[model samples]
Target: MYLTSMVFLLLGSSTSLLMALFSLYKSVGYFIEWEIISTNSNSVVMTLILDWMSLLFLGFVMLISSMVIYYSGGYMEGDSNMNRFVYLVLMFVVSMVALIISPNLISILLGWDGLGLVSYCLVIYYQNEKSGAAGMLTALSNRVGDVAILLAISLLSVYGGWNFVFYLNSICNDISMGLLSFLVVLAAMTKSAQIPFSAWLPAAMAAPTPVSALVHSSTLVTAGVYLLVRFEPAMHGSKLSQLLLLLGGTTMFMAGLGANFEYDLKKIIALSTLSQLGVMMSVLGFGLADLAFFHLLSHALFKALLFMCAGVIIHSAKDYQDIRMMGGLSKLMPLTTFYMNLANLALCGMPFMAGFYSKDLILEMAFMGSINYISFFMYVFATGLTVCYTARLVYYSITGGFNMGSLHSVNDESSLLTNPMLLLALGAVAAGAMLSWLIVPYPYVICLSGFYKMVGVICMCFSCLGGLCYYLGSFLFILNSLNYYKAVVFSGSMWFLPFLSTQNLMFQFLLNGLYLHKMGDQGWFENKGGHNLHSSLMKSSVLLEKMQDNSIKLYMMTFLFWAVVSIIIM
Candidate 1:
């Protein structure tokens, strides 16, 4: 089974890479459409759009998926449902590919729904209570995006077709199409877990590590940013762009702040994914779709490697996900440690690393753009918090005192895990440079001041110092003091987002749904619809039966009444 899976993965990776190269070098694209039906000038069609963007994104997705599956072979070596897990992961890959290549809304929705369903299945693969809850959150959050896409499709029907690409030029000027754009943005926000919709991304860590590596890094969360990128041509200079900028920046700041207070290993990585996602959305908001795509690809390489490395540590630590329970593994598991730190450095946008090429470039361009001071502060602080949390994570998990039990044994597991990490590590290190050259053929002309150029460096330095202070401050005094308790609770709990998205928001919807069922469907329809008609018919039937059962007295009374009326008229 594993061998067959490997063959399939390798074939997919090679094919996508080849197509990406061909599309890039030849500057060619293919858009194929099949008309299924037509009525009143509207057509229902299936479409496949293969261009350099789609091909390149597809290649990265397939490559990461390949590494994840191979890593899972060892990670799930003896699990009884390993075969089922592999199948679900493959289904997820297919769904993402479908989404990447399609230009039509209907076809995109098919892939969109496929990703949501398959992810739900994968999230609940463990078949336990916590997994079940997490799966529900993941499914429901994504369903919002699904419903938005459906609405977009319904709106597109009036345009005579479901293909959005052909309509991008006119959509900005037309008020009707503006709603379509809004729905698309809302869908992307939910899918990408921006702000209020973000609680689910961290909750979804209940799944196994390989799944985490796959879902968080490329396929699921990145789908929204990719959608927005495709829709960006219409969104530029519009109110939607400003709204996206606000929400994206806030989400970036929120996630980075929350990660510092979080201790769960997987959750930290998940929050980082959220932060990076916000960065991509912010760039898209800045009308830099190409840069957003660049970051997306580069981020996938390192983020996936980061998760796999975490998996190795968690597996060896007997599934202890708390960073406080782990420390000083650099000597015991040197290889995993090395790859993890590399990924971390890349995440922190260290000079010349994968993240540096994309993330740093984004900050530079943001400075070049005409953005507000609020946005400027968000970009700077979010960048710093990213480094701060990363440093804290590395210190707590790798370089600190040994905190695990004496009986615990930690070491580099096997070639199955190491080989995949090594492959992704290579990509994590080099993908940024390669993608920059290919995707961004021309260099961005920046005319920033010296202060702006040094902002990123300054942020990293101050953030590093803050991280160091926290690392040593734990012993000196109260790190999380009573004065900061309120702040900690707010940020630590994701600003109470889990409560808001689930208990608060959904609870109202549930009540309304139940009320509709009782009053609208059952009560109102019973009294005013079929039930009312039935009662009126039954009453008329009873009156007729009583009149028909008339006796001699009844006939006499009727005759007397008619005679009296006739006399009065006379």
Candidate 2:
């Protein structure tokens, strides 16, 4: 507790200093950097871009991580390895800082790989079979992006420099460097857990709650979005950008739908993160990197708060993550429920919350952009889904009956837990307006029809209807149709993405392919091609040596063979 308080104070000071720098840099832009390696065409430099974006983002990362650390002190009390957990979280923050500060891609690797490696360690920190499986899935899936980054670095060598700042400008004219855009998008998708790479995130819920709060908030998951925000100048208008736009919208829809079906408290929150990340990605795909960054910041605040609240609930309910097992805890834990509600409503983009500023702006832009109705419907559907699931989460977790058996106890408040949650809840309430004013110097060019302008509001109302219907309908047992169970099973389980990732056809195919390669290429090739080649050569050499050791008998045999060969030839 003493250490966490100290760390929070230290991080608070750092955040204030960075905010001051954020203010100062607006008047005079500056790159605080130190060159690490020098070459004729390229010099590898450790650089920090001190524009408002980096400063604001860096400040938020420090603040949230520090608060998470503080919350963990209470959340993790009595654990033998609490010290180890704290150190791991501290390292995660260090890597996150490195990622936020880096302007050079080569230097970004240090942070990028650090996040992957440390997250793997943290994911498996629980030391159980579930944790072990989740860790491997998380690490290996991220390994694809790591390899993509290394390939990107190699591809970057063609320009004789690894500084993305230098090359990003040339991206528009130098058609040759288009591959870099693809590589970057791929890397970002992997890091952010988009599409096929999306499975590891919810699986990562096997980690302790503090790790989820810190990592999912502004560190591990957001790293990829931040990377895209940095690379947006280069990737905008490219095929990769188009794909991100499409993929992002789909991810948002997929995750929102999945959240409605989910029962686990943590999984629902994880799915919400996925949906929010999709919103950021889609906006960036539309070439609005600033808007995307703004959403990223806003999402970080509330989402972190949401997870912290979930942690408190999980602790109170004695780790019953299933909402089915939970009930009306609002009376028991009024304070915690209030914080949870604030976070949930904010996540729903309820007016004036942090999510409203960015999400509404994104939805407005999505409607206004030169997109097909399919894309527009995706945006609208996904937005409504967000509200519906959040409403469901609140209804199930807080407003429902107390189903945790009579003996189990529920606490309404814990200062150790609520302190950090309250701090974040404050941000979640105010950050939308605050960040919008600070980050976006200009407003979005929203040229929607007046009727369309109200669509987002109406969509939320309709989403409220959907949530009401689902919640009221769940208890009423109204949906008894044939497809109802199928819909719940499919969408509720994240399109069975978890199953697909672990034991589905794709995993089976890949697993079999790997086995075949090991058996044939590695095992069979070494035995047959390698050893057989040596044995054949050795036998030939022995026969030649015998022939060369020519005595009278050998000469006679040779002569007889030659005569026989000659006869055969004739």
Candidate 3:
């Protein structure tokens, strides 16, 4: 089975390379349309768009999914439902492909809903309470995006077709049609897990690590960014775009702050994904969709590797996901630690790494462009927080004292797992340089004062201070538990977001509505209306049966009485 999966990986990788080459040399964009229905007012069609952007994203998705599938062979080997897992992953890839190729809302929803459904299945694959709760949160959160898309579809009816690509040039001329962009941005927010929808991204860490790799890397979360990328032209220069910019910046800051306080290995990584997603989204909202796309690709390479490394550690530690229980594994699992360190370095936007080329560009753009204090602060603080938490995490889980008891051996025993990490590590190391050349050969002009230009560097250095402080501060009882307990615990638990998503927020209200529907709706309505109607029909049937007596004597007496009465009246 692993051998078969290896073949699949090669095919996917080869196909992606070919597509990338074709995208550069020979590909000319085209749209294939199949008319589903047509009316005077509006038309629905299945539109497949093959363009440079779509092809690029499709290739990336295939490449990342291929690696994740190969990696899963070792990780999920002992599970009873391994086949189910594999099938779900394959469906996930197909849905992502569908989403990338879709040129219209009608076709997009097919892929979008497929993603939501398949992701829920994957999240709940373990069938535990945590997985169940995570799956529900994941599903409901994405449903908000789905509904947003539906609203956008309705608003887009004025254009007479679902294909926004066809109308991008003309859309700017109409302010009334601008509502579509707002709906689209709202949809993007939910799909990308920005701000209020963010609780689910970390909770979804309940899934197996390979699923997280696939999702965070290229499939589920990237769908929203891809949407914005495709819709960029239409949304340009609109208030909706500016609104997204602010929201994206806020999400970036929020996630970065949260990651610094998190103790869970996977959740911290998940929060980092959220933070980077905010960067991609904010760039797009700034109307530089190309920059966002570049960051998206780079982030996928390193972030996927990050999640794979986390998987190795957790598996070796016997499912202990808390970093407090992990320490000094570098001596035991040298290879895993090497891969882990490389991925983390790339995540921090270290020089020459995958994150550096894109994230640096994003920050510089924000600095040079017409940006306000809030956005400037967000970029600087978010970048610092990213590095700070990453450094702190490395100290906790890799270099600090060995916190766990001697019960299990921790080493890189599986070649299957390490091989995938190695492959992704190569990307984490060199993809930035390679893709930077391809994606952005000539950089955007940043006319800033020398001191102002050093802002990003200053923040990075400050991040070192922040990381050390956070790590050391964790040891002090007063800081960890006493006076700052509320602040510490608040950020540590993602601002009680899990509770908000599951019990304290919209989902709880939804659950209550379901309960009301079951008890009040079905229960009372059934007895009062359905039961009464049933009794009334039964009573009428009995009365009719008694009146229709089949006895001949009763019929003759009734006839004779009627005949005598008629004669007396005459």
Give the lDDT of residue 75 in candidate 1.
95
Q: Global CA lDDT of candidate 3, please?
A: 0.85
Model 2 Cα lDDT, one tens digit per residue, 122-175: 999989999999998898789889988998999888877677776787875678
Instruction: Judge candidate 2 at residue 418 and give its lDDT.
Output: 83
RMSD to true structure for each model, in Å: 3.6, 3.8, 5.4
Candidate 3, 129-191: lDDT as tens digits: 989988989999998889989998888878777788888878767788777777788888888
Worst 10 residues of 3 by lDDT: 474-483
lDDT of each: 0.91, 0.84, 0.85
RMSD of 1: 3.6
TM-score of each: 0.92, 0.88, 0.88
- Sorted by lDDT (best first), the order is 1, 3, 2
TM-score: the better of candidates 1 and 2: 1
Model 1 TM? 0.92
Candidate 1 Cα misplacement greater than 4 A, ranges: 35-44, 526-570
Give the residue spans of candidate 3 off by over 4 A: 34-45, 476-481, 515-570
